[model samples]
Target: MGALSDVRVVDLTQVLAGPYCTMLLADMGADVVKVERPGGDLIRSSPPHLDDPEAEPYGGYFQSVNRGKRSIELDLGADDDRETFLELVETADVVVENYRVGTMESFDLAYETLAERNPELIYASIRGFGDPRTGETDRQGQPSFDIIAQALGGVMEITGAEDGPPMKVGPGIGDLFTATLNCIGILGALHHRERTGEGQYVDTAMYDSMLSMTERAIYLQSYQGSPPTRCGNAHPTLFPYNAFAVADGYVVVSAFGTNHWRALCDGIDRPDLADAYPRPADRLEHREEIHAELTEWMATHTTDDVVDRLEGSVPVAPVQDTDAIFGDPHVHEREMLYEVDQPGAGETVDIAGSAIKMSKTNPKPRGRAPLLDEHREELLAELAAQHEAISEK
Candidate 1:
């Protein structure tokens, strides 16, 4: 049994955020039933490129997020299917969905509707803004994608360089972060349910979660002087505490403490240079000179040389690109990734492993993501039997 072996999640979510949350639960040994519509989730059709657009149901994006989930196709709008879904809520420990604000209500499947059947259900909703405050209709109208969440929530403003055009990260970082926040809230509510024999709603707007991540910028405006600016690769508090040039790539050095500054001086065999700048202002004033000197010195050294001379002794690291990150020693030891032999992708593709560790329960991947509606019959039978039983009494 894994950490969440007892939890059962009915995933009425599609695309990213809600699905990602259910994926986390499924990864930890929860029973996650992915209820898709008749046409299946739109992600199945999304592409970087597919071997066969019509034939291949497991696209890369869909496959990655939906792992360890059992899929069932149903038309939630159908009267029989709606009753079937209500049956699922009656038995579910949690129901996670990312439908627009009133989408569930429109289908007559809102938390209030589900809660009447199963008051013990942990109902989670992922919206664009929030349900109560942020305009409900605003979220319901047009689809608010991941970039929309980041772009509107001040993430884009502080992402790239101060002068450069605002940029979104390569991955759907906003959705993933918001999904994680949703998981945290759901877990809390679940624990409360276990204790008090009660359940509650967990709602988080992706925009709200994104805004929370920019706390320093937002909070600084109310109290201190200025809103935080994008410094590219620079740290907030110290000089020489950012990425620096090196022989093959780069190294990040944090000369934060006086002792660390002295250690750098001692390590580089430049004691006199250390005394030249003792305080923060001293380093800040001569930052260019210091950076230039450090860069020139680093240009002579390899990444190994950087680590060998001052890895633990000082806060410095050789900048690792993608390959270096995968081959890093710690990644191997911790099993942070796994080489999974995928169905179509022939060779083993490295996938991220579980971050959460449990001493007694080992959470291993049970199965790859299902083909569209792969377990439809199995789950439909489950719903039919459940609805039948509920109607009996």
Candidate 2:
């Protein structure tokens, strides 16, 4: 049994953010029942399928975030299916969804309605601008995706090269960050319910999450009275904290303090430069010159050579691509890369494993993502049993 083995979640979410949040809960042993529309999640048809082209549904995108959960088809628009969903919610500890504003109320499945059925149900929503119940926003009705969140939330403005245009981050931090925050909110509500026998509404906005992630820019703008721009790989305050090109690849190095700067200089056999810029402020002032010197030094050496000389002395790591990450011993040791069998693909594939480690109940992916409505009969039987038990009482 896992930490959340006793908890049951009715997941009325699709795509990245909502699925990811419930996936985390599912990893912790929550009985997550994913309710899909009749047509199913659009991501099921997303590209980059595994080896089998003929596989029924073979998208890594959908499989990665929807793992360890049971799925059932439920057309909420239909009266019978809506009633069935309400019954499921009545027995659930949590109900999570990522629909746009006012979508749930149209079907009469809003948190208020669900809460009436099960007073202790923790209802959570992940949206682009958050629910108005928490706080009103001008953009409450506007639909937003990851890039929109990144751009409006100030991360893109301070992410690229100093001379280049604003850039979107490679990964979808906008969605994933909100998902993580939603998970935290749900956990907090669960704790409160445990103590007081009361449930609450939990919500997180993608834009709000991105703003929180880029808090450095907010503080910088407030303190300096000016917006910060992109500085490429270099930091705004710390010198020698940037990526340097090596013989074959790139490596990031950080010499934040005087001691680390001295150690780095010594490692590179540039004690003269270190002597010239002894203080952190001095180094910051001559950042360009120092970067040039370090760049030249690194250009002549391989990534392995630089790491060998400064691995323990100064913080340094070679920039890794997916192939390098796949073969990394540290990743394997930490169980960060998990291999699971994909029944739809008729083969095994590697998915990212959970990073949140618990001492007593270490969470991991329970199984592969289910095929569409794979657990329909099983869940119906379980629900029937639950109803019978409640009736007997």
- The candidate scoring highest on TM-score is 2
- Top candidate (lDDT): 2
Error of 2 at 267 (Å): 0.6
Error of 1 at 34 (Å): 0.8
lDDT of 1 at 255: 81
Question: In model 2, what lDDT does residue 222 have?
Answer: 96
Off by over 4 Å in 1: 47-56, 133-142, 339-341, 344-348, 362-364, 383-393
The digit string of per-residue lDDT tens for model 2 on 212-278 reads: 9999999999999999999999999998899999999999999978988999999999999989999
Cα displacement (angstroms), candidate 2, residue 391, comes to: 1.7
Q: Encode model 1's per-residue lDDT on 10-54: one tens digit a residue.
A: 998989888888888888899999999888888976654345434
lDDT of 2 at 329: 94
Worst ten in a row by lDDT for model 1? 133-142
CA lDDT, candidate 2, residue 389? 97
Collision pairs in model 2: none
lDDT of each: 0.79, 0.92
Q: Which regions of candidate 2 fall more than 4 Å away from where they truly are? A: none
